[model samples]
Target: MISWLMLAQAAALGIAGLVVAIAGLARRPFGDLALFAAIGAFATLVVQIVASIIAPIAGAGPTGDLLEYWTYLLSAILIPPAAVLWALVDKKGQWSTLIVGVGILACAVMVYRMHQIWFVQIA
Candidate 1:
């Protein structure tokens, strides 16, 4: 994974997490802003997926276990949409929104871990 791309993904997810967290705390339903934020973060993961494929071909491959890195990347990609779907289905108000926020934050952390697996850990 590219360093800048990883950082960007983390930042985007972090921002989305913060947004939903604030809305959830304020007792707001899952609104357009939160939805858009989640979508935006998901878009970043899509970009990361493409980058992961291209970066390896360009000789910037992971120094660690490629399988581990890809697994993390793929799993991280699934989180946002799942959270959004949960929020939509639950309709339990703030808790549902908070769930989405927490999910996005978790994704950010996973992205950081992916960075470690790709660039820091070396077997």
Candidate 2:
């Protein structure tokens, strides 16, 4: 993975997590901003997946286990949409906001791990 791209994605995920978490704490319902942030977080994962594929062809592949990295990539890609769906299904209370918050946090952690795997051999 590219270093800058990884950092940007991690930061975006963290920001999204913080936003949703704050909304949950404030007892705010899911809204456009939250939805956009969730989409943005998910889109970041999609970009990461594309980068993962293109990087090797561009001679920038990670030094870690490709299978493991791809597994994490795929899983990370699923999180946002799944959380959004769950939130939509459970329209009552702050559960939706909470789920999005937790999902973004999980994405942040997963992205950090992906970065680690990418740079493991170099370090």
Top candidate when judged by TM-score against the true structure: 1
The Cα local distance difference test for each model comes to 0.85, 0.84
For model 2, where is the 10-residue window of minimal lDDT?
114-123
Candidate 2: which stretches are off by over 4 Å?
none
lDDT per residue as tens, model 1, 20-83: 8878888888778667877887888898899999988999888889999889889988998998
Model number with the top lDDT: 1
lDDT by residue (tens digit), candidate 2, 2-104 = 8988987898799889889788778788777667878988888988888888889998778888888889889988988998888888868667887888888
Give the root-mean-square deviation of each candidate in angstroms.
1.2, 1.6
Per-model TM against the reference:
0.93, 0.92
